[model samples]
Target: MAALTASQAPGVGLGGHDGKGADAAGDASPGDGSYDMELPPLESPNPPGGSAPGGVGDKSGIPKSVLAAYKKAAKSLATSTPGCGLRWELLAGIGKVESGHARGGAVDKEGTTLRPILGPVLNGAGFANIKDTDGGRWDGDTTYDRAVGPMQFIPSTWARWGADGNGDGRKDPNNVHDAALAAGKYLCADGRDLSAKADLDRAILSYNNSSEYLRTVLAWFEFYRKGTHAVPDSDIPPVSVPGLGEPGGGPVKGTPERGGKDGGKDDSATKPGKGSGGSRGNGDKEDGKDGGKGGGHDKPSPEPTAPHALERATDQNITAVAGETFAARPGVRAETAKGKSVKGVKVRFEIRGSTQATFEGGAKEATVTTGADGVATAPALAAGAKTGTFTIRATAVGKNLGTVDFKATVTAPQADKVTRTETTALVADKNGTFADIAVKATRKGKPLAGTTLTATLADTAKGPFFSVDQQGKQVRTPVTVETGPDGVARLSGLRADDKPGTYTLTLTAEGGAKVEVQLTIKG
Candidate 1:
């Protein structure tokens, strides 16, 4: 049965009925018996605008397809089985309490829940264990069948009460319309009048035996009936359904296991399980087994064991250049308290320091499972653009195990080596004015474009050198020039002062590399 709670929504109770003395009719039955109740005319809570009371629309977070199916099923039940007081809100309430309208999964326009929903295996730990009934055809567990569909019906129960709400001829539990109609029919069976508080409680309890389940369904029912907004209150603890609570709360191992492809028989529907009020066992009473007295003996449920153990992530230190990719060393491991390796444990990797340093080959917040060796390996880690240290954290699912942090250091890029060459030496003409001297810069024999070259005379103010303007007048001795694409820089119009002699010309590149050339001038 679905373990929904409405503590989040204030004002609990269904239309003022508090469920006290509501079970006077009898303990709720798992939806399996055939009802002889008269079918009432079908009606819809939603008006022409497809909005229910309290102005709740799709914004209520209830899917439109699911809401429409509820209305359709309610109308179908009322038309086919009159005088049952089957309201669309009541059907919707059941859907919400059972599976969150298929846990925000896919529901098509034809009122079909395209995604298959399965509950956990009833393995006697926080649940009743029933052997497989359908050869793993329905719940996928040949050993034990689970409840299936948005309404959370066990396969055996579905076989007994399944109906084709969409007129599809096939009665599929995964179809919302079919499941909704089947639920409505189950609620109105035995000619139970739902207009009365006692009858309503009896009908809901019949679906699931928990008093808290009744309150939750009714709370959602009232929420829909009044047309209030559908914000679920966080304060209210969610009820545990097969595969919908803590690991072992449901058939699967995870929190709020919405739905999966597994199939199984529902123990609550077949046997007198947790919420069945200890009444009928395995649908035998109606079949004339023990004459209405539950004759099947139930074994005591097993106690919950401690959670699986997880060790801190190993190889937490990594170093790399900015924007470089490297393996995330120190893989994480999952193990038992005895220090033995445990495989298939889910480990979540989270980025803590910089968004730039990401888990390469996967999502930033990716979850990877441990391999056979109990070690979970992370994809390559790419450092961010800037140089700094960041942290990546690997934590076990549910944190029941533990977590480890990996630190990464990124450094700046290194500079390249360069050399300077003078393609042409400096020489003075008869007037003692020198021609342009061409110099080239290269890094490892390849032209190093964009290098800056500066020329300085051995003596700035003395006889050897001087610079000239466009008009041929002496200017200065030191000059700065930038190299072009071919790595060539030109120093033009160097003039020797009237005193001619051999002079030293120093050419310096940006990185402190210098070349000295002898210049000869004629007076």
Candidate 2:
């Protein structure tokens, strides 16, 4: 296994590079058939980022004809072994690294110096014959005998494990399709799954028969995973923050109904109002404190005393206002062995994700810290963001610590907009009612009627926007539209049965002018 360190080269400035793996950084050979290139350290056999030159790695010096050939090779390899866990792009990177895209049949070779290039003959167990043809005999212990084909598979292992990856009847080790399949199989073989770091490390070791290979592969995997597109955290739609949507701190106080299997008690019922438990001993009535009698803390009759056992921290729930910085949320809860709140207990916070491994372009990492109220708050998030999930872990200055998880759900507050507004915004004024609103289509500020306006309820944000193409998924109800001669369209009887969130009203004018306004509705 080979361990390649990340390259420390600065950003390459290649205005004319145009995706070519050439001397983008002002280092080019004068028709010497060579070019200088800088790379991040090669700590792993896999490229640092999932991307390599020429759709796999940099190949600027190589002519476009060569790049086309390599791309064609990559496509064939990828399509051949859809079942293989290894990506063709990674395999292509290995090909570019091992043989310089050379597809000629195996050249008789031996020794570690040329092992990566002559991998096919060595790993295929036919090295002795090829070596004999080349007027050389195998030393049997050299790195040359261990090398495989384009992606470098060892012959002894490949002979038993090599597969017809492309299923083209010929298990040609020299062929990119076969070699890539073999590499994929070798990487994802039994007890080797790329998803797990340990398994991926093990698979990397098998590829080149070295621990260094495992390390390099891990580094490359990290780089690739980060560089590729991943599921975004903001895909979820914004919802109104609980207990803050209505006037006067939301819904007015109502009768306290016992929470049932359906909806729970309203905000006012559970709010921290007068006579609510606010003492530190709210978990119990011990020491003459004000809490439910014998609330589990009063008596610890059967408990065993263990010096190594850590006490459980109790502060779990925290509140934050929407659109405000989340830094007020406490990262840690102070507590004692008796479950009592411990003030001034110091704790540290940290966060992690797949993005942390590589260099990020100024993206802020989430931070957690305690405040005067013993609460930790998250950073101020951006607007229009729909999704976020975060975990706040706390470590006591000593060994005892705890963790809390939080997810952000954005509920866009009620706002009036000339173009887009929720339905509630239209009918929200209980004291004032506007009659028969007229919707008119205009082009260049002139009324143009006889147009069609289709209204659709937002299913799940983007879901509603594209629902017209969703076939049966969209609701069967239709939004009625009436057009007047002055290009005025009147729509009425919009019912509450329509899905909440953003509903788009698409207007298509007679002259093909079109516009869409999103309306949000609340239940």
TM-score winner: 1
Tell me the TM-score of each prediction against the true structure. 0.37, 0.25
What tens digits encode model 2's per-residue C-alpha lDDT throughout 1-523? 1112111112322111222322222221111101012132443333225342323442222222222333454455446544434543444334434443332211111101111122222222211211211111111222223233344443344444455544543343444455555556555545344556555454444343223333433444444443422111111111111111111111222412122343232331111111111111111112323333321212211211111111223334432322323333334444322223444444554333322111122233443343444444343433222323434344444432323443333332221111222233343122222223355664445454445555444343322322233554534244545455675665544433334443555544433444465444453
Instruction: Write candidate 1's Cα lDDT for 265-296 as tens digits.
Output: 23333332332111111211222132343222
**Model 1 RMSD vs true structure:** 20.7
lDDT winner: 1
